[model samples]
Target: MKLVAKREGLLMMGFKGFTHFILVTDSQEAMMMLKSEMDWRSNVGNFVEDVRLLIIERTVTDVVFQPRSGNGIAHTLAQFGLMEGTHFFWEDVAPPWL
Candidate 1:
């Protein structure tokens, strides 16, 4: 959410009363975290609580899981991130290799 806020030029105040979020991940555990409540005593409970708060606060609407085979482009991007130690911001056109 912090990365998204930076990308979208949003401040903490901007989250108030905001809606319309779609989260896509390849991890089943991440999907489950979004779908169910987590035990407060668990090691990653704080992170889970934060995500749940976003949902309860109406900042996020949906979460989807994409299989590795179904998300080749994303897989490639992940590799790029690892290789270059950088992140990308797409606007008008993507890199030629992509």
Candidate 2:
């Protein structure tokens, strides 16, 4: 489910003319997986491969990791979205308040 959401996010980024991406994750294992060679024999492998393609095609630049301890703005934005029951997809521009 996370991978699927990631793909969808890349799609939006691509649509927004984003040429670089800095990926964030909360797990060392996931960070390692993103850095390692992709596999072709499993569903997870396929998802990884797909993301790689998206990265290259969309000109995504890098993937980075942060420990779960960070009180980042992403967490706050996500919390606001959930509390407000607001699901938004920016097509032409990001919300002004953002």
Candidate 3:
């Protein structure tokens, strides 16, 4: 699900003409999988593949790990996304809420 979200978010960013992003996640494993080479045989490989394909077109400048315990803002934003079905891209400066 994380990979799927990352892929979809990146796709939207590309459509909006953004070329770079900093990916934040609670799963270190997912970050590593995305940064390393594609593992075609793994069960989650397809999801990673989708994200990787998008990365090829854009750029992932960094990957930060934000643990859930210290991630109240992310949690809130996620809930907002779920309820509103909206995608936001904040660049050059932090989001107003942040």
Candidate 4:
């Protein structure tokens, strides 16, 4: 079977007067992953380090996790990612659904 590689990218938006970040997700495991301290022994640790760096640099003053209730526009965006293979970018104006 042929394997298809998935590429994911992060888009940073400028929000005025927002000092903290709250990430909402349905996965408790992901919440734990993000909340854990950076572990220097594993390959995934590098990703943890990146997250730590973001916090250290004050890119996000604070980070928290919230449980998603399968509602809202974010749920729609998540659905889009699942169906469309999660490779897209936009600037200025977003699509009408967003």
lDDT of 2 by residue, 1-98 (tens): 44554676778788778876676766566557667885657887777777777878887677777866784655555556667775557567755777
In model 2, where do residues sit more than 4 Å from their true spots?
A: 71-73, 76-87, 90-98
| TM agreement with the true structure for every prediction | 0.62, 0.66, 0.70, 0.54
Task: For candidate 1, write residues 1-98 as lDDT tens digits.
Answer: 22232223222324344466665667777678667755657656666666666555655567778887998886786667668866565556877899
Model 4: lDDT to the true structure = 0.47
Error at 74, model 3, angstroms: 2.1
| Model 2, residue pairs in steric clash | none
- What is the TM-score ranking, best to worst? 3, 2, 1, 4
The candidate with the higher lDDT, 3 or 4, is 3
The count of backbone overlaps in candidate 2 is: 0
| TM-score of predicted structure 4 | 0.54
Query: What would the per-residue lDDT of candidate 3 be over residues 11-86, giving only the tens digit for each residue?
Result: 8888888887787887888888888875767768988888888887888787678797888877676666677787
The runs of at least 3 residues in candidate 3 whose Cα sits more than 4 Å from the true structure, single-residue gaps closed, are 38-40, 79-98
Measured with C-alpha atoms, the lDDT of residue 77 in candidate 2 is 56
Deviation of model 2 at 43, angstroms: 1.2
Best by lDDT: 3
- Which of candidates 1 and 3 reaches a greater TM-score? 3
Q: Which stretches of candidate 1 lie over 4 Å from their true place?
A: 1-19, 40-43, 53-58
Against the reference, the lDDT scores of all candidates come to 0.59, 0.68, 0.78, 0.47
What lDDT does candidate 4 reach at residue 47?
A: 58
